[model samples]
Target: MDLRDRTHWIFDLDGTLTVAVHDFAAFKASQGLPADRDILRGLETVSAQRATEIRTALRQWEADLAHAAVPGPGVIDLLEHLRGRGRQLAVLTRNTRANALRTLRAAGLHAFFDARDVAGRDSAAPKPAPDGLFRQLALWGAHPDEAVMVGDYLFDVVAGRAAGTATVLLDTHGRHGHPDSADLVFSELSELTSRLATQPPGQSIGGPHASQKS
Candidate 1:
């Protein structure tokens, strides 16, 4: 539970590290999908040819967005603090590896992680599934208990809980829609970074359990 000493940090690339620019609604509309449908899951039910076309379009959209990627508030500082503490860092995104790398480089965060540490949809099943998180943990040689999954959405919390890792929700808007699965909630990355700088190792952030169960 001492994050400084033992924690491995697995992060969601898009909204977590970078400014939220992906308009899910727009992306869905572009694919002729319902506004509320999960893109990946929806693609699964489509014809192979159609699915390929949608994926190709989605990839192009993501590539374009990558060119405009901007770091979220405190992203650089928080990442530097964690790196200075020797925490293992990795990215588990639902994006393609190529897109993830582009965003990371564009946001100036590419140095914090190696290519192997960044797992995208092509690497494993996406968030809300434990596959990508587990895969990253395996590569890091760390157990779930020694890692924390940080993201800005419910899917991230669910995936972290499903993988038996601690979950930190970056709910910048104060929406408490998915509190049950999150071990800690912060309105800003800076809040978490500040806590890490001031709190003792193994300190609980008001969670019933310091480490979550799958």
Candidate 2:
């Protein structure tokens, strides 16, 4: 549907805001973990002490990656437009909160969001779960129908759907694209900005299947 009507905007960091760069499979391999295993879940099977150390190291590694974060095309314009309209923007990333904040600064987007609104892996159950979105909505005193989640992966779409908010999927870098599950799909942030520019009040972009394939 049309995103302009939504007041609360929850976004996934990493690939959604910045260009994709983290090599997750490689990270798992380096940890002696199954490449396809979900890293967080995998940690659950380890000794509590060992898990703590890994978690500490993982957060640090992600914080380091934040130093090189780069914003996707038209991302600044999109954020400016949303903020000008008084939208509440929050991040719900799977990274640690410290790393997420670091990413915002490194990408020159720290001014766009408040530190309190940034939710990371430790912030909630980690997406594909709706806990973080629910918390954000609660903080804003907003409803699911009044918010939208924008991200570049299945977990984003699933999490938003579970939370009852509209979902927008960015199928960029040829990664984790799932149009059938999103209320809107675009190849780039610039395209989404264009739609917002022309969107008429009360008009939604389209249904779940509506998308602009790259």
Per-candidate TM-score against the hidden true structure: 0.91, 0.91
Model 1 alpha-carbon drift over 4 Å, by segment: 201-203, 206-214
Per-residue lDDT for 90-170 in model 1, tens only?
999999999999999999899999888998999998989999999998998899999999999999999998999888889
**Candidate 1 at residue 134, lDDT?**
92
Provide the global lDDT of candidate 2 against the true structure. 0.85
TM-score of 2: 0.91
Query: After best superposition, candidate 1 residue 114: deviation in angstroms?
Result: 1.3
